[model samples]
Target: MKQTLVIGASLNPSRYSNLAIHRLVQNNIEVKAIGLREGVVTDITIVTDKINFKDIHTITLYLNAKRQVDYYDYIISLQPKRVIFNPGTENPELYKILDENKIHYEQACTLVLLGTNQY
Candidate 1:
């Protein structure tokens, strides 16, 4: 399983980001998370700062396209193997940037992918 980073993570259990964190852990995939406010989802701490994470194979975004603008460079800098747009988070500008940098990306739902064993 790929080591994944869950961006826009939330403390709220109802948020998909929170659910994804739990699912990823349950599946035995190494996972890290970040969000606006510091909190915990299961045993994973939701980091509030933008720190570079090494050896990250994938980044699944939960923020909307607008909210994602600030993290574009930060995310690209991480240079993960791939970025998952995760439904409403899709941004053409970021896609172009990723394409130019030879980074792969997918506009899909993380939960769906996990449920179908496609993640």
Candidate 2:
């Protein structure tokens, strides 16, 4: 199974990123999370720093396109198998970069993918 990184994670229970983290854990998936604020979601701590995560299979983005700009190079450095552009986080600029690097991406909802067993 691929380890998932939840970017733009939130402590708010209502947030989809938070929900996705819970669901991912519920499905026994290893998950790491990072966000602007420090918080905990289940057993995982949402770190404020952009730690260089290893063996990251998937990166589920929750940040908006503008916010994503700053992390473009950082994310690419992690070399994830695919980047999931969850809803409002899609960016064509990043998509082009991913393409140039031969990285795969999907413009889809993480919650839906997990629920449908397609994650």
Candidate 3:
């Protein structure tokens, strides 16, 4: 499986981002995480900055719309096959920009997708 970057990842176990990481890993999916704090989620390292991740087939967002604004350019630069606007991260402006760049995207739940084997 190609890599999936989890933006807005959290070290907090209760967070959906945290749960997603464990699920992704268990499903044998490669996951790269970006969070406010640098830490480890199981074997995955959560970095605090944009590090130009490569071969990223999917980017699953965990940030809210406003917070996501800061990553618009960075996300576009990654050129992932698709961006998953998970729950609270949906942004219309970013969607337009992605459309202009010809990047595929969807507004859905990452965990749901993975759980259903539809990811």
Candidate 2 worst ten-residue window by lDDT: 34-43
TM-scores for all candidates: the values are 0.97, 0.98, 0.98
Best by lDDT: 3
37, model 1: CA deviation in Å?
Answer: 0.8
lDDT tens digits by residue: candidate 3, 1-119: 76899999999999999999999999999999999999999899999999998899999999999999899999999999999999888899999999999999999999999999899
Which window of ten consecutive residues has the lowest lDDT sum in model 3? 85-94
Displacement of the residue 81 alpha carbon in candidate 2, Å: 0.2
Q: Residue pairs in steric clash, candidate 3?
A: none
Ranking by lDDT: 3, 2, 1
**What's the lDDT for all of these models?**
0.92, 0.94, 0.95
Residue 18, model 1: Cα distance from true site in angstroms = 0.6
- lDDT tens digits by residue: candidate 2, 1-119: 88999999999999999999999999999999998899889999999999999999999999999999889998899999999999888799999999998899999999999999999
